[model samples]
Structures are given as C-alpha cells and as structure tokens.
Target: MSNNNLIKGSLQTIILKLLEEKDRMYGYEITQKVKELTAGEIKITEGALYPALHKMEAEGLLTTEIQQVDNRVRKYYSLTKSGKAEMSSKMNELHAFIDNLHRILNPAIDPKLNL
Candidate 1:
C-alpha cells in the first residue's frame, strides 16, 4: 500500500493530535511539523490537508483565525472544545486499530498466544 493511503486513513487523528499538543497551527506549519516529527516518512500535501481542514471546520471540530505575518495572510487552525473532546476518543480508536494491525501482521509472535 502507498504511504499516502496509510496517512490518509489517519489524517484526522494526526491533525487532531498535533493541535492538541500545540495551541494553534497554520497549514504549512502542520505539514512541516509532521515531516519533522516523522523524519520525512510522511508528507501531507496541500491537496489533501486543505480539504480535510475544511471538512473538520464544517463539522465544528476546528476553528480558524486569520493573521498577517510576513506580508501574507495565514489561516491558523485550532481545535474547538468539541474537537478536544473528540481527540481522546479518536486516539483510543487509532491505538486499538494499530494493535489489531500489529497482531495480524505478526501472528507468529502474537502477544495473545504468549509467543
């Protein structure tokens, strides 16, 4: 599977978790942060990131602020109260999914079998 496909599935969780850690972030900032944190393993393109951000805003999971910096307007995204509440749930879901994937991919060493 392509890295984009894998990242796409967890994009929401990734964005929410990042916002949870930092108070607010702009689009480019989010993209760079992810690259830095993952050591270039993942790259979030504007094509993918903006659509998701707009969707989350429509869903009331995020709010935005426009700021002028370096002679340009930057739209910063921050989690809403509901977004913060949803982060914990999303994180737990992601963790559970990862655990399941790990088990399936490593059945010979499955912890459930004490192997």
Candidate 2:
C-alpha cells in the first residue's frame, strides 16, 4: 500500500478523474474501484473519503443522490456540469506537476524535452 502522506494531496484528483469516467458511484464503490484500479496499492479510508466527498459537494464539483438499496441508503456521487468542464484542466495540471517532480528527482531528464 502507498503511504497516506503521498496519497493525501492527490485524493481529490483521483476521485474526480474516476467520477469523470464512471458517471456515478457510491462511497464504498468508489473505494473498491480505486483499489481495483491500483491493484491494492492504494486504499482510501472512510475518514478521508467522506470529508473529501462532502467538501467537493460543497464546492459544487459534485452532486449526490440518496437511494434505497436493500434496507439501506446509499449516497451516489457524480460530477456536476462545472466539474466536467474542469476535468481536462485539472488532469493537465496534475500531469504537469508530476512531470515537474519527475524532472526534479531525475536530473538526467530534461522536462522541456517532449517525449
């Protein structure tokens, strides 16, 4: 499993990107999907996940719907219209940040050189 410190900053990006592709997902479903995607390298705790979800909802980046599922209520989340529009830019920004970090860590590679 990856360190929580490393995973912390990118959680929002990860969630947003997943929602961008999956259309809609519930909390546990999101956790499971992320685990499946990363092959168990990353695990999102409920403590971290819900706060982020709620914050995003408050920020208008996500919307939620509560559904009755087998005697339980499941809150499903999906990206809003504004969130969809922001996806590309957010992804690009993330990629650029990673690339810069890569260059900083590996002195032999020039970030300016398009690969």
Candidate 3:
C-alpha cells in the first residue's frame, strides 16, 4: 500500500510510543524509526510529521527544544506530563486496534474470533 493509505490515527500512537522509548526525538529520527520499525510499510513524510507534531505541541501533549547540530537547527520533541499519561491509553488502544484488524483479516485463524 502507498504510504498515503496508512491509517492516519496510527501516526499519533507511533509518535507517542517512540517518545516513550527514546525519551526525546527529532522529526527526521521519528520518521526514520517508523519506517524501520514497520519494515517500510510505513513511510512518514515531513508533510505528515511536522503538522502532527505541531498540533501535539500546541495541544500541550509535547514540548520541543531547538538545538544546533553541525550548523543545522533541529527541533526535538518529548512527551509532556499529559503526553506520558496519554501514552498508556494510546498504547492500549493501538493494541486493540491491531487485534481487531487481525480478526477482520484472518478471522478463521483466530481461535477466539467468532467471525
């Protein structure tokens, strides 16, 4: 599937989970990690990432710190207190979503699934 077809809601979960692990991450790193972790099934573009990040920041779910590296400026994002709290719920929701998708895709293979 093209990257554009990726379920949009998953992006927030990805960002939150990555922050939970990495503590802090810059935009490019987050995109790269998503690509690598998903085996390129997910390709996060700057167009997709930047706006979400900004929105999260605006919503007080994330905080950013700008730094200079090799004469380049980079903004790193980390979870705020609320962001941390939200991460747990987001993780559970993601798990449930994947479970549902798996059921839909391979219902007969799932012993617990009736459909």
Candidate 4:
C-alpha cells in the first residue's frame, strides 16, 4: 500500500497532539502545521483531514468556533474536556507503539548471548 496508509492510521493521534499544543487551529492551519513540523516529510490532505475532524466533533471530542476573518469565515477546532482525556490516552498508546517498533527495527543483542 501507500505510505499514507501509515499516516492514516495515526492521523487521530497526530491531530490530537497538534491541537493539544496549539490550543485551537483551523483545517488548513492544521495541515500546514503538520507539514512544517515534519519538515516536509509528511502532508495531510483535506480529504483525510475533514472526515477525521467531523468524526471527532461528532464524538464530542472537539468543539468548534466560527469567525469571520477578513472576507471569509473560518472554523477553528479546539479540544473539549473529553478530547484532552483522550489525548493523554492516545499519546501513551502512540509512544508505546513507537518504542516497540523501534525495538523490532533495531534489535539489541547482548554480547554474552550473541546468536
């Protein structure tokens, strides 16, 4: 499959972490922030992002505010109480997964027990 499949699986965690740090962000802002943070290594598409945002909003994990910016209206998303709690849980899960993946990819061998 595509590398996006890997990003897709972790999209929720990525968004949650970003919102946690930034407090509030608009859709395009979120995408740009991710690209900036990853130094152009990753890009989040509108197709994947909006659906995830909608789903999180439906689940009560996010709250939105609409404001008129210049001539356009922008919707900003911030984490709700539930979202903060979920963010903590998701962060722990992601960390553990990363640690496990790292171990698998770079196995450590004891010199005394070299196989």
Candidate whose lDDT is highest: 1
lDDT of 4 by residue, 1-115 (tens): 2389999999999999999998899999999998998887899999999999999999999999999999999999999999999999999999888777766676784434323
Over 4 Å off, model 2: none
lDDT of 1 by residue, 59-87 (tens): 99999999999999999999999999999
Candidate 2, lDDT over the whole model:
0.90
Cα RMSD of all models vs. native, in order, equals: 2.2, 1.3, 2.6, 4.0
Q: lDDT of all predictions, in order shown?
A: 0.92, 0.90, 0.86, 0.91
Error of 4 at 98 (Å): 0.6
Candidate 1 stretches with Cα past 4 Å from truth are 109-115
TM-score of 2: 0.92
- Tens-place lDDT per residue, model 3, 1-115, is 6447464767887898899999899998998998898798778889889999999999999999999989999889999999999999999887787788887788577658643
Q: Top TM-score: which candidate number?
A: 2
Better of 3 and 4 by TM-score: 4
- Taking all chains together, each candidate's TM-score versus the true structure is 0.90, 0.92, 0.84, 0.90
- What is candidate 1's CA lDDT for residue 2? 32
TM-score of 1: 0.90
